[model samples]
Target: MTLEATDVSHGYGNETVFDGVSLSVSTGEVVAIIGPSGVGKSTLLRLLALFDAPDRGTISYDGEDVWRQPEGRRLEHRRRIGMVFQDASLFDASVRRNAAYGLRVRQSWPERIRHGFAQLVGEQNGTGDAVEALETVGLADKVDQDADSLSGGEAQRVAFARALAYDPEILLLDEPTSDLDPRNTAVIEDAVLQARDRGIGVVVATHDMHQARRVADRTAVLLGDEILEVDRTERVFDDPRDDRTRQFIDGELIY
Candidate 1:
C-alpha cells in the first residue's frame, strides 16, 4: 500500500506554511522529513496523517482519495494509521493502560463485550498486546508503573509502544527523539527500523541529520514551505541537487 500527497498546500489563515509539496511512502519504507525549525515538517506530517485537509492538494491512500471518502471510511482508514506527537502525550495512568488506550478505544462494542468476558476469565485482551509492544520498546518490566512516574525517555517509549500496539499499517513520528539522550534515541530508532521490517510504512520528521541518515530509506528536505528535494538518503545528504539542501546539510543554512 502507498500513501501520497500531490501538490499539497496548507496554511493558518493568511500565513502560508507550505505549498505544492509532494511526497509518497509505501509499506516497508521509511521516509524522513528533514528541515530546520518552522519549515512545516510537522504540518506536512499532519496532512499526511489526514488530521487536516490541505488548501490545495490531494492525499491518497492505496489509490483512493482520502478527502473524498465518507467520514466512516476516513475514520476506518485512520484506525490503520498511528501517529506519535512530539511531546509523547500519555494518560495519567499505568504504562499498560496508556499503551492499550488506542486499541481499546478502537474496539467495536461487540468486540469490547467479548474482550470484557475474556478479561473476566483472566484471559489476555488489549493489555496483552500492550505488554507485547512494551516489551518491543524495552519497557516490559514497567507495565504497571504509573506513566507520570517515568522519565521523559521512558514516557516517549510508552507513547511509541501505544502506537505499535495498534498494529497500524503506517506510522507517523514527529520529532520523537528531539529531547532524548543517545541511549533513548537509539532505542526508538531501533524500534522504528523493526517496525519497517514488519512492512509498515514509516514517516519520520526530524531535525537531526544523523538520525535521519540512520533511519530513512529516502529523505525529503523541506525549506521555504516546500519540499526542496526528495531522493535516496545517501544522495540527499552526499550529493544534493539543490544548493539549499547542501547548505542545510552542512549547517550553513538557517531560517
Candidate 2:
C-alpha cells in the first residue's frame, strides 16, 4: 500500500501553513519529515492520515484521490491507517482496554455482542493482540493498571500500542517521542522499526534530527512552506541538495 500527498497546500483563515508539499511512503518503508518547530510537520501528517482535506492538492491512497472518494470509501481508507498524535489522549480506562480500543470499535455489532457474551461466560475477551502490542512497547506488566495513573511516557507508549494492536497498513506519527526520556524514546523507535519490518508504511514527523537519522530510511525536509528535499537518510544528512536543508541540519536556520 502507498500513501501520497501531491502538491498539497493547507492553511487556516488567510494564513497558509504550507504549499505544494509532495511526499510518498510505501509499505515497509519509514519516511521521516524533519523540520524546525512550527513548520507544519504535524499538519502534513494530518493530511496524510486523511483527517483533514488539503486545500489545493491531492492526498491519494494507492493512486485514488482520498478526498474525492465517497464517504464510505474514504472511511475504508482510514481504517487501514493508524495515527499517534503528540498528546497521548488516553481514556480513563485500564491499559489493556485502551490498547484494544481500536480493534473493539472496528468490530461488527454482532461480533461485539458475542465478545461481551464470551466475557460474561468466563472466556477471554480476545485481547491477545492488545497484550502483544503492550509487550512490544514494554508495558505488558502495566496491562491492568489504570491509564490515568501512568507517567507521561507510559501513556504515550499505550497510545502507540493502541495504534499497533489493530495492524494498520500505514502508521502516522506526529512527534511521538518529543517529550519522552531517552529510554522511552528508544522503545518507541524500536517499535517503529518492528512495524516497518512487518510491512507497515510509517511516516514520522519529528524535529529531532538525531532520531530521524537513527530510524528513517528516507528523510524529507519541510521548510519555507514546502518540501525542499526528500532523499535517502544518508544523502539528506551528508550531502543535502538544498542549501536550506543544510542550514536547518547545521542549526543555522530555525523558524
Candidate 3:
C-alpha cells in the first residue's frame, strides 16, 4: 500500500503551519521527516493519522481518498493507520488494558481472538491480542503489570503495542524515542524495525539525524512551512540538493 499526500496544507487560527506539503510512503518502507523545533513535524504526523484534516489538500491511502470520508469511516481508517506520540502515552491500567484499549473502545464488546497462535504471532503474551501486542514490543512478561509501573521505554513499548494490536496498515511515529534514555531508545528502535518487517508503512518524525540514518529508507526535511526535500535516507544526508537542507544538517537553523 502507498500513502500519498497531495498538496496537503494545514494551519491553526490565522497562522499557516504547513502549506503545499507533499510526500508518500510505500509498504515495508520507513520515511523519516526531520526538521527544527516547532516546524510542524508533529503536526504533519497528526494530519497523516487523520486526527485532524488538512484544510486544503488530499491524503490518499491505497488510492482511497481519506479526507473525504465520513467521520465514522474516517475513525475506522485512523485505526488502520496508527499514530504514536512523542510522550508515548500509556494508561495507568494494566498492560492488557493498554494494549486492548483501542479494540475495547472501538468495538463496544471486548475484542475476541480466535486462536492462541494469533496472539503469539503478534508477539504478545498468553492473553491473546493484548498480550501479543506487548510481546511484539518485548513486553510479554509484563503483560499483567500496571502501565504506571513501567519505565519510560517500557511505557512507550506498551503504547506502541496498543497501536499494533489494531492491525494498522500504516504506523505514524512522532519522535517515538524522545523521552527514552539511550538504552530504552535502542529497544524501541528495534520494535519499530520489527513492525516494518511486518509490511507496515512507517513514518517517523524526528530531530535525530542518526536515528534517521539508522531506520529511514527515505528522509524528508520539513522547513519554512514546507517539505524542503524528500529522498533516499543516504542521499538526503550525503547529497542534500537544497541549501536549507545542507545548512540544517550542518547545525544551522532553517527556521
CA lDDT of every candidate: 0.93, 0.94, 0.84
Candidate 3 lDDT, tens digit per residue, 61-174? Answer: 888889787888777777788878988788777888788877665554333443234555764433477777788788989877888999888888888888888777899999
Q: Whose lDDT is greatest here?
A: 2
Candidate 1 lDDT (Cα, whole model)? 0.93
lDDT of 3 at 168: 78
Residue lDDT tens for model 2, 1-255: 899999999998999999999999999999999998899999999999898999999999999999999999999999999999999999998898899888998899999899879867967687999999999999999999999999999999999999999999999999999999999999999999999999999999999999999999999999989999999999999999999999999999856
The local lDDT score (0 to 100) that residue 219 gets in candidate 3 is 98
Q: Each candidate: how many clashes?
A: 0, 0, 6
Comparing 1 and 2 on TM-score, the stronger one = 2
Residue 115 lDDT in candidate 1? 83
For candidate 2, the lDDT comes to 0.94
Q: What TM-score goes with each of the models? A: 0.95, 0.96, 0.90
Tens digits of lDDT, candidate 1, 39-112 = 89999999989999889999999989999999999988888899998898999988988999888988889998
Each model's RMSD to truth, in Å?
1.7, 1.3, 4.4
Candidate 3 global TM-score: 0.90
